[model samples]
Target: MPVQKMDVFDVIVSGAGPAGATTALFLARAGKKVLLLDKEKFPRDKICADNKTWKCLDIVKELGLWKQFQKLPKAEIYGVLVASPNGSEMYTPLHEKDIAERGHWYNVKRIHFDNLLAQAAKKEKNITFKEKCAVVKPIYAVHSKTHISGVTYHDAKGKTHDAWARVVVGADGSQSPIAKAVGHSPVVKGRYATNTRAYFENVKGPMDRCELYYLKGICPGYFWIFPVDKKTCNVGIGMRPEDFERQKKSLEQILRETIALPQFKGRFKKAKQVTAFKEWGLSVLGKRRPCAGNGWVLVGDAGTFAMTFSGEGVGPSMRTGKIAAQGIVRALNENDVSARNLKKHYEDALWKILNPEVKGFRWLEFLLLNERLFDFVIAKSAKNKELIEISSRMQHDYTLSKKLVHPKTALKMLLS
Candidate 1:
């Protein structure tokens, strides 16, 4: 997978999503020559819940896209509306302090959201942003196979080209070629989720609250109708591939049947699907993957950063991209791209920031595994404002997410 023709940069980023775009922008701003490549052209359609939490907006502000993002066509989300199998429910609002300070959460379609960042990246003098360039594999230094030197990619013309860099980044998605080159592939069963989504217009739902449903059939796997605006909603469902096997239905079938359920049918009676149902796989393990290595680091899905319980990745991806930039900048300045420095500056530092919360959610994911427990959890949460507040913060910054698995919290859910 080596290439004879070569171009060089200070950093080569493999994907141009939030993670890669953020990394490229930060690196470029730091005066690093960045080669940012993406498999698709700009304004491409990406299947996502398309919601960006307030925490995600913090990074958007940092990237200098806030003012522009504010001008985009989107929804300002206030909270989540969740229902359990028995129809017991809870609505967890974003912390008021944050809502006052940052205007709370948003639902921006990924097409507009990603293009905003990518367009910004393209404008940076230090960044060479290439669209429609698909990476083939990472190029390792001839002397050391462990040290990634750059990448080989297939251009839009199907011609191969090489781009060398002091450090290469695998910001590519879960099925990353670079990830596989580093031996991070072979998707682990039960650590994965199969999901399906589609856009619909004329859906009747609360625009300010994301609607989530946990039903007997879907059980731990869940369904959502996250409104993008007044007239449209992003409808989707997720299931553990292992669990989905027992259902004996396709992801599309599950989504269709879920929508056809009596309760949902009333809401969508006049709503029309604007897009075809699409399926995607996610790396949902809360445990950290090997993200940093000699001359390279992974971010976003490539690093398996999608949340186990919620399947949310945008916030984590941008957060990791921001940190990955810091690591790359430090590495470039010190002229050390070894595994040790990247780990210290990137991996270790990242997990230190995310581990507790992530570990906590991993523990809490158990609640979503069963219909009975989910019903109880939602029921208790609706009755207890304190519970709603804790659940709200848990999605962002509750450090002791694991504690909820024990103590009076568990007891409260059991006995309430």
Candidate 2:
């Protein structure tokens, strides 16, 4: 097969999801030539819970895309409803001030959400957006095998091509080829989560909030009901891969059983599934891994920046992309694309912003492992105004979440 040589760019971002698109958009806006490639075409569906919090909205607002985002088909999420294994439920509104200021958070289908970002990237004059482009591997420097120089991919016509870039970003999801080619691995074992989601029509429930059910059978994980629109809902379940495999039950089976539980019986009685159950892997954020190296950087799931407790990746992923772009811009300006330089500016800065939350969420996940402990926390939050306020604020601000995981607070929750 003849390999075609394409124009060299300042940055080549693999996987044009939220991370890739955000990175490309920022780089392009800064006047850098960017090549954004993805395996799937636009308007494609991606496996996700479709939930977006204030953090995500902040990014969208920064990009000047909030008005456009509001125009997409979505459901407003006023708060979160968490149900414990023992049938105890608690509703934590997403910060009273935030609700009053922003109305509500949102749940938009990934297909639409991703397409919106990709489309925005397309409008940037410096960005070259290409769909149906599948990146195969990182192209290493001939003299140094460890240094990535560019990438080789197959275009829509099945033609192989070599595209060079000063920096290659692995914004791809969990199973990223660039991550493996760059010798990056998950820092923590059993940190990945397996999730399955499907769309349902006429899901009988209040469409104003997202629901999370923490059952005994799936400790450390939860089943979610996220409304996507007036008549449709994104229903899904997530679990640690080991726990999922140990149960010896398929996601579909677990989901079926979960819906039939006494608490959710009537909610699905009038609901009809409109889509097949689709499974995906979430590389939940835990231990920090190498994200930037010679001529390459990883963002999104490829960098394992997804939230540990909520499996929320969109906000973190996009935030990392923005941060990575800032670092890349500085590296390009300095004419230094070496691993040492990129790692110092990119990885270090990214970790500075992400490490605290990742560590805090990891501890929270640990506490939720015990059914009785988890139930106690949820039940208490229902009656404790202080605890409920802290929980609600934690969803929007990581600083507040740290307080919840503080030794003092943890001890109080444990004893109470």
* Candidate models: Cα lDDT each: 0.85, 0.86
Give the number of the best model, judged by lDDT.
2
As a TM-score, model 1 comes out at: 0.95
Estimated TM-score for each candidate: 0.95, 0.95
RMSD of each candidate? 2.4, 2.3
Error of 2 at 190 (Å): 1.8
Per-residue lDDT over 19-62 for candidate 2, one digit per residue giving the tens place of the 0 to 100 score: 99999988998889999999999999999999887767888988
After superposition, which runs of candidate 2 have C-alpha atoms over 4 Å from their true positions?
A: 1-6, 100-103, 186-188, 402-416
Model 1 per-residue lDDT tens digits across residues 1-416:
98566698999999999889998999999999999999999988888899898657999998878899988889878888878889898888888776777777889899999999999999999999999999999988998889999899999999989889999999989988998889886376567878899999988768887888877767677899998876888999987777788889888998999899998899899999999999998877566678999999999889888767777888889988999999889988999999999999999989888877766776667767656766777787788766777877765665656555566787876676
